[model samples]
Target: MREHPNVIAVQDALDAAGAHTADDAPSLVVILDEGAHTAAAAAEALCIEVGQIANSLIFDADGEPLLVLTSGAHRVDTAKVAAALGITKLRRATPEFVRTHTGQAIGGVAPLGHPKPVRTLVDTALAGFRDVWAAGGVPQAVFPITYAELVRVTDGTPTDVA
Candidate 1:
């Protein structure tokens, strides 16, 4: 199979987000793996612990896009996250909803390539890794980024979302 167009879009977004500048580039290694559609698959492909993979989960908060970049080893408790956001509810977004908001499919949402800045929350657990990997707008692609750099590129706030 060839590289998906969405992957190219992600590279462009990364460049536009200043994630691709030669000096500021955070050693993000975008790997293409046919089997890497989930965090487990990606970890296996990269030979890294699942916890080191940052899973970009999308949630809908009364129609608003809520992007939560959480650790692959942890499942986010929606109740706690909703309370953190002081919202009445939080639900997992459907694939279509996720695409509508982030312009990327589930399992392949890039941390910084959404059509707009969704209210983003970065899991505190991600800070444990000096380097982390996240999807690059396609299921078969991923890139390396640091916790601080991810936060900066996504305009996300670090919080205990896990």
Candidate 2:
């Protein structure tokens, strides 16, 4: 499972960016015994608060792919985000569009392991947690990272997404 192509890509991207957990440990992707298709499920599996899950969401920002790493406990306020970004139209991306740009399925897009660099916004809400968990390019895999590291690694702007 660790060698899964998607996981490998995620790990390679993490390494290249020097991503680390809150404790300064190297971020290593781990495959859960069961697939965590949602943030609730992932938090339950990892025995952590739902807010600690950094839900990787893909959105269509006026025709371009946009990534938002928001906290599981908060729903993304698209209108607010769009207004803040000065985007004419910001809506949820279709599954096909998400897969096309992220090279990963809807439920498992990592922050940094994409086919191309999508414009990203890290939710300011996520900074409250010491260690946030993110998808590892697949539904069954995840990795731990700090809020600062996540923003830095993805070159994402810190924004209030909710």
Candidate 3:
């Protein structure tokens, strides 16, 4: 089946960023019948540990959109993140806010391909896994990438999110 347009956009973004998946272990985009909207669902579908899933989350930090690529194993500690960023508050972005910022729905927000650059924070915890799976701008589509590559591609700041 042909890939979704949103997924193609993500693939194009990765390519433009020179973030190719490893040639030896080519990372193909997988499409699932059931949406891998949640990190748990994605991990189960990909047959990997939950922690190997990178959950793309958007938050409203001091009225700006902030992207947090957190691990599936734990929840983000908003307080810690806010304090670390020297922000007064960090609240979860609503569906409308997510779509507006990411140009993608909540469940399939990728680290890249936003209409404009969004400040990103990648979880240091994801470094524990050699490879991690992330959304591909569509809930049913997913792709594999290394934690380091993810950080480089997104130009994300590495920090502890949990």
TM-score of 1: 0.90
Across 1-162, the per-residue lDDT of candidate 2 in tens digits comes to 788788999999999988899788999998999899999999999999999999999999999999999999989999999999899999999999999999999888899788889999999999999999999998999999999999999999999989
Worst 10 residues of 2 by lDDT: 106-115
Number of the top candidate by TM-score? Answer: 2
Each prediction's TM-score versus the true structure: 0.90, 0.98, 0.93
- Error in Å for residue 103 of model 2: 0.3
Please state the error at residue 156 of candidate 2 in Å. 0.5
Stretches of model 3 off by over 4 angstroms after superposition: 22-27
- Candidate 3, residue 44: lDDT: 93
How do the residues 1-162 of candidate 1 rate in per-residue lDDT, one tens digit apiece?
126666776676666666632245544537574848788999999889999899999999978889899999989999998997888878999999999988888878887767777888999899988678888887878888788878888889999986
CA lDDT of 39 in candidate 3? Answer: 90
Candidate 3 root-mean-square deviation in Å = 1.6
Which candidate should be chosen as best, given lDDT against the real structure? 2
Q: lDDT of candidate 1?
A: 0.81
